[model samples]
Target: MDLGFGREKRLLTPQQFKAVFDSATHKVSSKHVLLLARDNQLEHPRLGLVIGKKSVKLAVERNRIKRQIRESFRHNQSILTGVDCVIVARRGIADLSNIELRQQFDKMWKRLARQRLAADQANSTGQTNA
Candidate 1:
């Protein structure tokens, strides 16, 4: 698969970030991460990372978390289509290894994808019945 974390696959502006936070329809939380997801009109998935200094403390640690998150998202882009996701780093997340972080993110991404598929099916069925 083509795994490239391009600018188009990132939530860049304040308005875009606010839209995801304000209208999130799915959320998945793990020990050190909380993923908030919203359905978007686009054909591909986009990601936003919120590794605040208040939570992570050091810039090096925060950058590591962001890199891991982005890498995981890049590899799972196909399954995450049509969704905008924001990953918020919780306190103590900096201690987790990259493997553990990827595993948690993978689980949450699958759950979010399933939720989106179910919602789409329900909408399609309702439209057909009407």
Candidate 2:
């Protein structure tokens, strides 16, 4: 229940971000966002955001979108454990309000959790079959 957006919960290095992008096992996408996730072999989830200037245009708007994404991730971190997630902002994301963004993020997080569960089950079942 520690819901703080700590430094440990952020994808800080270029190599870390590249690893998630290059080897993501799960992806969730909407009109305004693309969420790519890979297992990080850690106890907590980490977030990396890519809000390109070409898509968002203004620095203020991009910063606002990042804030919304970080807040949403922080609130849902418990359920998002053991994954490194990268959220790429698409063109229309800047137009949405914080509430709408949060809603979208919530859905994406649920989808990711489901995928993780299914993958775990598959692994367990495969081991049993062997």
Candidate 3:
């Protein structure tokens, strides 16, 4: 992935998302998905993508999605701070190009930022925090 155009703050490890998924609150929808990730607090925001065989039949297709996601994250990971994210693909995602993938990723990132800000505001208010 040629992500040198932007710097990514990544915590690249399986255990990171695993721990968050084990105990985190989450929100999901067709346009975007997210987890209220706080497991890897001391490190920078990180990302993981699950492109299963069921989503993309061929290994090459699956790898392409993974690569696109990695590049997307590398290019935009800074927008997500103090959180861990894992983007699991739906079955229809294989045909998207790198640009399309990035656009989808940007949408997801925007949704995530909205959620994070809401969560922070809720926390500050001691209200119903996700």
Candidate 4:
């Protein structure tokens, strides 16, 4: 599978980000990060980053955090299909080192993948029972 971080794998427009924000059906969070996700009706998952200055304070720090998030997503995209996710950065995230950031995102991605699997199973079973 092509696990590249291309434009098609990113939530480029405000409208796409807004859709995930407004109707996020799954949420995974930590002290300094929150991940919100919903079904996108697509073949691959798209990622949106919301690392505001208020959270990270400096542009460099925010960019670093975004890079870590995107890298983690790229490595885990195979298991994250058919979802649109928005990762919101909170205060204190900038304090984490690169290794910590990577670990945190890896944990969050696993949780989100599990949620997606459960949702898919539920949908399939619900359809059959209907």
Candidate 5:
């Protein structure tokens, strides 16, 4: 498994997850609901995804969706700098093909850009080396 953003050091822990969830700004895009998050407000890019069982009950289905999301970020992490993004999968996701998934992600990112937090290379990098 590709784990995530490459390095394991930067992945979100339960503590970090809580921090962002408690204070991050949020928006709903046509594709998915984007959780625009920050820690104490950290100033680097970070990302997390939540594909619920309700949306894709089978592990295989959920994992496939997750792989799609992670790969999207791994390649486009630079586009979103300072803000942390969390994509919580909804039921509709179960029906999407890769093309449709990308379309949805694009929509979500475009919407997220409006309220984005700037990313700084220093302090924290934009991704977790998962």
Candidate 6:
């Protein structure tokens, strides 16, 4: 499994981030973060993080949050195949410990996966019935 989060696994451009922001197909949120996901055409999933300074004042905190988010995404990337995911940090996120953030991401990833699977099944059945 290619678990490395290389450049190809990142949403690198403005357009790529905008695409997910404009028409996110799946959403999973918690008190400290919100994740928006849209299906993409690639064979792998891509990730974008929006940990603004307004949300987390210190640059060090922001970087820490980004690291945690990326690590979580790397472990759970398989569940997010062919999707573009943007995770926006909310206020108070900087207060959470690494373990707490990890747990939150794990739960959110599972929820998003269940949602996507349900939607895919619904779409497939709808097309067959049409």
Query: Which candidate number has the best TM-score?
Result: 6
Compared with the true structure, all predictions reach lDDT values of: 0.89, 0.93, 0.64, 0.93, 0.63, 0.95
Residue 52, model 4: Cα distance from true site in angstroms? 0.5
Candidates, ranked, lDDT: 6, 2, 4, 1, 3, 5
Report the lDDT of model 1 for residue 60. Answer: 90
Question: Where does the lowest 10-residue lDDT sum fall in candidate 1?
Answer: 1-10
Off by over 4 Å in 3: 1-14, 31-39, 127-130
Say which prediction, candidate 3 or candidate 6, comes out ahead on TM-score.
Answer: 6
Off by over 4 Å in 2: none
Q: Say which prediction, candidate 3 or candidate 4, comes out ahead on lDDT.
A: 4
lDDT of 5: 0.63
Estimate, for each residue in 56-127, the C-alpha lDDT of model 1 and write its tens digit.
998998988898888889988999988899998899998898898888888888888888889889999999
How far off is model 2, as Cα RMSD? Answer: 0.8
Worst 10 residues of 3 by lDDT: 31-40
Question: Per-residue lDDT tens digits of candidate 2, residues 1-130?
Answer: 8899889999999999999999999999999999999999899999999999989999999999999889889889989999999999999898999899989998899999999999999999999999
Tell me the tens digit of each residue's lDDT in model 5 across 57-117.
Answer: 8898788888777766665655565666666677778788887776677666655664453
Ranking by TM-score: 6, 2, 4, 1, 3, 5
Of the candidates shown, which would achieve the greatest lDDT relative to the real structure? 6
lDDT of 3 by residue, 60-130 (tens): 97887777777776676566656767676776787777788778877766777777788777788886543
Q: Native-vs-model 4 lDDT?
A: 0.93
Across 52-104, the per-residue lDDT of candidate 6 in tens digits comes to 98999999999998999899999999898999999999999999999999889
User: lDDT of model 5 at residue 98?
Assistant: 82
Could you tell which candidate, 1 or 3, scores higher by TM-score? 1
Once model 2 is optimally superposed onto the true structure by TM-score, how far is the C-alpha of residue 95 displaced, in angstroms?
1.3
Question: Who is ahead in TM-score, 5 or 6?
Answer: 6
lDDT of 1 at 115: 84
